[model samples]
Target: MTKITFVQQDGVRIDTEAENGSTVMETAIMNGVPGIVAECGGACTCATCHVYVDNDWTEKVGGPSMMEEDMLDFAFDVKEASRLSCQIKVKDEFDGLVVHVPGRQG
Candidate 1:
């Protein structure tokens, strides 16, 4: 399992393990990590699962796909670091990924 960290809007950091093949948003929901609404589940249709991948891990986590990039337009506080969590699959390489949740949804 890959360990992921979710930094909530209020500065709370929640750490949990995500099984391989699961998405980052799914891990957050399973762990009760706040700020990841995932309204459209993992369909990549919405941006409620938006997150800011920590600068240090961005390269490793990779960028949004063409579809995810389009969906990100609906996210709040879109940044160079922004990503749709549902699009990020948990892999062994993502053992220590860190993501920050926005203060509010778009």
Candidate 2:
């Protein structure tokens, strides 16, 4: 299992253990991390699971795909680090990944 952290808008942090193949969004939902609504599940359709990859992990997490980038257009407060958690697959390399949840979904 890999460890991932979700930082809520209010600055609350939720730490969780995620399966190797699961997405970060799944980890958040399973751990009941508030602010990650995942309205479209992991389809990469809705941006409700949008999050900002922590500066330290942005490069490792990489950028969004073209399709995901399009979906991110619907996310609130899009930033250089903005990403759809559903698109981020958890892996051993992501053992300490951290993401910030927005105040609202777009």
Candidate 3:
């Protein structure tokens, strides 16, 4: 398992464990982490699972797929580091991944 930290807009930090190959959204929802609605349940259809990865880990996490990039356009406070959590598959390399959740989701 790998640990990932999710930081909400209000500075609230949520830490959770995830098994390799699971999506980040799955880990968050399973652990009851706030700020990620995951309305589409990792289907890549809803943009509610938007998150901004820490700058240092951006390259490590890689860029989002074209579909995810398109969905991110509907997310709140989109940034260069923005990503749909559902599109990020957890792995040992992401052990310390830190992502910031924006204030809104819709």
Candidate 4:
């Protein structure tokens, strides 16, 4: 399992053990990380699961795909590091990955 961290808007950090092949949104929901409202599940149809990839892990996490980018247009407070958590698949390399939850969802 990979370790992932979700930092809430108020600076609460939720650490989770993520199974490989599962998306970040899934892990957050499973672990009850607030601010990750995956309205469309993992279908990439909504930006409710939006999160900002920590600067230190951005390159490793990579940018959002074209489709994900499009969906992110509806996300609240979109930033250069913004990504749909559902689009981020967990992997061993993602251990210690950190993402920040926005103040609200779109």
On a 0 to 100 scale, what is the lDDT of residue 37 in model 3? 99
lDDT tens readout by residue for model 2, 61-102: 899999999999899899999999999999999998989999
Sort by TM-score, top down from the best? 4, 2, 3, 1
Model 1 residue 106 CA deviation (Å) reads: 3.0
Estimate the TM-score for candidate 4.
0.98
> In candidate 1, how many Å is residue 57 off?
0.3
Quantify all predictions' global Cα lDDT against the true fold.
0.90, 0.93, 0.92, 0.94
Ranking by lDDT: 4, 2, 3, 1
Q: What is the lDDT for 82 in model 1? A: 95
Q: Alpha carbon lDDT of residue 105, candidate 2? A: 90
State every prediction's TM-score relative to the real structure: 0.96, 0.98, 0.96, 0.98
Candidate 2 residue runs with Cα over 4 Å from true position: none
TM-score result, candidate 1: 0.96
Residue 16 displacement (Å), model 3: 0.7
lDDT of 1 by residue, 1-106 (tens): 8999999878889999999999999999999887888889879888999999999999988888888999999998899999999999999999988999998765
Compute the lDDT of residue 104 as modeled in candidate 4.
Answer: 93
- Summarize candidate 3's per-residue lDDT along 5-106 as a digit string, tens digits: 999888989989999999999999999988899999999998999999999899999999999999988888899999999999999999999999888997
